[model samples]
Target: MAGIQDGMTVMVGGFLGTGTPEILIDALVEKGVKHLTVIANDGGLPASVTGTTDRGVAKLLSAGMIDHIIASHVGMNPIIGKGMNDGTLKCTLVPQGSLAEKIRAAGAGLGGVLTPTGVGTIIADGKETLTIEGKEYLLELPLHADYALCRASICDKFGNFSCYKATKNFNHVMAMAADTVILGAEKVVEIGEVDVDTFTTAGVYVNYIVGGEQPWQI
Candidate 1:
């Protein structure tokens, strides 16, 4: 978390509350940085929605740490609307599939992606569009970040990571899209303890590791 500073662009791995690195996120809150541009699927569940504590990115949102967001949706958290209406926050909403492809394009080292998702909608406004074979496509550029926060169900000392079911949502691809990847795991083991085939993401993409994350309350 030391490498992340004010005004940095951060990609947070999650879909709602799932697959989010809560421990690492809390550490960022404790780090007290500001003016961050966060890229994610959703804004996460607010305490009001969870009926418990704030979950996932809601922690940062409530602390007013993020100044801007590039996400698919933010309806889960009411704060997003309030902040935007007051001019304290800036938000850019991308289609879910397009957002995923943009992140994937970055990881794949591609210039951009051609998608027809927003052709007749406002999402295509001010964006470059091209017609090939009578179909229109928008040019969505790769989305990179200064740092990425990812969650894992288990990880070895060398960072071979694993997560089950919905937990793999953004964590896998996000690891490859950032300059540095910080992993927060529910369990950590030594090398060879877990079979190599069980690993979903290779260890090579991870930069730092933190362990003992509890299951998300949400």
Candidate 2:
């Protein structure tokens, strides 16, 4: 079915909006794909904040399906934090900006990038440092995935995707980095429905499209 499987690395798009695909997330849950490694921000939040308890891929985290996560933060999800403390969830937190650049580099087929976000912090603990000009920059490696789970505001039948406002976070670079890209959207339209200027991810990057469920009330 060209679906997700065990031991696969997945990049989930969204900071809080544009990158989440509610439909795809549900499908993954229905399929019960296990032993997964996810890369993104905010695995999911509690139902109080997000109207749908299933919001933000929290379902997977809660079901004990995932094995590892590489993200900027876990958001307001208490369940995932508990899983971490209990040794059920393994996590690696990265700087938000560095995470974005690393994914972009992967999509661009670059080895990695040099950034100054963690020059003297714990983020640099095991990383290499280089002096560029007069400043030191930490080298963060490129990060990609076997599959990418992302949300678009709208997607044409031809697979063109558009993100609205802050929702556009991470989807663009994530689309490029994954071997397979799945999209969930609030609306689906024809190829010409959206202006080319506003299209953040091109049709070429998408492999599947599903209509997203209404967001949880967070």
Best by TM-score: 1
RMSD of each: 1.0, 1.9
TM-score of each: 0.97, 0.92
The residue ranges of model 1 lying beyond 4 angstroms of the native Cα positions read none
Q: For model 1, give the RMSD to the true fold.
A: 1.0
lDDT of 2 by residue, 143-197 (tens): 9899998888878887788888788888889999999998887888877776777
Instruction: Give model 1's TM-score versus the native structure.
Output: 0.97
Q: Give the local distance difference test score of model 2.
A: 0.81
In angstroms, give how far residue 6 of model 2 lies from its true place: 0.9
